[model samples]
Target: MKSIDTEKINVGVVGLGLMGTSLIVSLLIAGHKVKAIAPIPEDMEDAPQRIREHLMICEDAGTLDRPVDCYLSQLVISEDYLLLAPCDLVLECVIEIPEIKRSVYKKVEAIISTDAILASNTSAIPISELQKGLFAPQRFLGIHWAEPSYFTRFMEITCGAQTDAVLAEWVYELAHQWGKEPTLLRKDIRGFVTNRLMYAVYREGLSIVAKGDATFEDVDKAFRYDVGSWITLMGIFRRLDYLGLKDAFETYNRLAPHFCNDEQIPPLMQNMVEKNAKGTRNCLGLYSYTPDEAKRWDEAFAAFNVDIYRLAAMYPSQREKKKTRV
Candidate 1:
């Protein structure tokens, strides 16, 4: 009913992990008042410090002119759901478990206003399935964000079958105000857009290494040097268009059946998990890393996100041309 453009509506975030905290910082930077719920004593204890670190990152990037405390003043980390009754939008960012997310939605729906739009930052779950057993399914949609939400300009607003189209548009415009390159998906689908494409790459890359066709570094080297050079500017289809080559079509015909399309989890990844090789968080994953190197990679990626976000802003992705009938 009201204009979302240039509006500073109250927003509520249900989780306080890295993604949730990063999202809260992004909202604060976009001039919205936010109520964030960490839901656990440990998370609540760390939320303030985590947010302060991000605020300082923004300060150094020259995006936020005010001191960290100035933005901190706008955020409320609360344990109560009643505090969220006034929000215009509420996003659930719980872990990727269905039961945990369903319980959160039920609790959040009970206290919020009927008109408040409910959204999920779910990367893999289907919004249509998540809307089951909700009183007002029309208000629920998926608002998937790329990690380090404060830095990444990408946002996906996906609408389930029951979602209200008008509410989805309001959120779409709001994402633009927050400095995001937002997309609206009219239909709900698993993994939405980005995750689906990215996971395909993951599956193929892992298969290559597991089959001993290449080492982890070799795969990374090829991707970084080849795909990396133009991915930030244009996607694969556009690159193919510019090159006047359809080499991939013939290559795919030869390789389609050979590609890994197994329904079961790869033994490679399962063994890694069984061994507790959990990547930088645990200092080992697909590739081995010393503790110090792991820490450096983590910090370096965070730093790179800030600058890469700026560069992405400078050259945002373009929408594809719609094919017209002859």
Candidate 2:
């Protein structure tokens, strides 16, 4: 088996949903050869076009330096699992079903080299649970990526009970090459870090609305205007420090008891799910939208992502600091 080369490695992605194709673009941009496996027939038919469109968006956003074809040429999309034989790393972005994921893992493991790493892009599944039955459980881990992988700098590299620490560290470092600010979670936990934090906010937001303290629109405005203002520049902890720890301490003490602690799913969300509401995708959501309104919201979000991607680059997490006086 060939050794893993951070500069020019062969990476394979199994599953070709929107996130999978977007991730292929990120890998290609990072100068790696990518093999994408479309497990479902529908994805197989749509993967190539979806990839092309994402690359085109990158070009328009001025994120793609070379001709789009240059990157696309380095990708191979197929149903053949054998093509993954040369991959140094393979990440599965399939459904969150454990059975389906385990089956894909079995197939990929049968073809790839022993040294090759296998990972999943599961958002909420515990990495420890997913690695339970894998042939080489030590090599299996979780590498969660935010949507629009090429644009977002968010990534989380998680370790299961049997994960090789050294291998996970290598991936954590390599994630920087893919333009991510990756967090390494040495211990596995359900919902990982991002989901836990975001879901807490979601629960509180939903509860507030359900209790008549605020409407959905009111919560959305507060989140967008307040949290959205400084969240990009500084995360929760840092913002607390930036504002003043004393104020945060006092607020937390006063508000802790009143915050939502409901263990059950929020009724508003449950109702929406029961109605098959997919937000902007189907013009049905917390707030109703006409078909054209939904389309506009969808387009606006894509454009916003591009703008924010560029803006965030200006204040990167690793920005070099100026020397201070002794």
Candidate 3:
């Protein structure tokens, strides 16, 4: 397939939740004409206002380069799939149900061009399965984004079993243009890379709490002080290399067996779900807080992540440093 060579491409985003909205805004910030579609009419109506508020946030944060109305002018919000017909790319950011995603993909495929890039924002779903029944599966791949996508630099680009290599590479280059430090997975894998690594870390962290070795607060503190210190500078393996890989190997050999090996959902999470615990959103979860306090904490976290994003930029990873020099 030929590469998407245009400086600005027409893109469509299906399922206009926070993710879809953030994506459209980010794409608009990068000068793309976006067609955003949400299932409900009310959500479509509010999408523009939500984007405007986000643009204001970006303006205050000094990230906005152009006027907010410019982005809104480039964006078209609708409930109809036909509006996506002119798109050069379409991203499916719907709920994480296989059948639901397949239905959306089928509908999107019917409306968009045969060669238009079709991507998913799935975190755990395997793209190989998501490509089933597509009119052109070769154009389908996974393009996962993290929360608050417009601000974060993390993106994961994955290829399905039948995905075209050239198209996948094209997406990789496009990701860089989107101002992302995206990892392109050569093979489609369940959980891809981020989720797998994060879950591994979660398993161990939860195991510690379950075993009563530490409280949840202690775990959070440990992460905030320990991993937070250098995670922006280098990843786990790179940090190991900095310390001494042989020493890390020895430590892993001694400690890996003790890490959580349970396949079943831990009671800590299951019980929380049963209780309808939703952290700050519902004022319940690992730690309880007053509603107003919880709201502040949530806002604090949102602002803190932005500041951390800046720190991550300043302490660019070794690869980033080398790339800049070259």
lDDT of 3 by residue, 196-236 (tens): 88888888888889989999999999888998888777887
Q: Which RMSD values do the candidates have, in order?
A: 3.0, 2.7, 2.0
Q: Which whole-number lDDT from 0 to 100 does residue 60 have in model 1? A: 84
Q: How many residue pairs collide in each prediction?
A: 0, 0, 0
User: Against the hidden true structure, what lDDT does model 1 obtain?
Assistant: 0.86
Check candidate 1 and list the clashing pairs.
Answer: none
Residues 168-268 of candidate 1 have per-residue lDDT tens digits of 98898788778787889999977888878888878888888888999989989998899888988887788877777678778879998888887677788
The segments of candidate 3 whose C-alpha lies over 4 angstroms from its true place after superposition are 1-6, 317-326
Best by lDDT: 2
Across residues 168-242, which tens digit of lDDT does each residue of candidate 2 receive? 988987887898888899999778997888899899999988889999989888889999999999988989989
- Misplaced by over 4 Å in model 1 are 245-248, 316-326
Q: Considering summed lDDT, which 10 consecutive residues are worst modelled in model 2?
A: 317-326
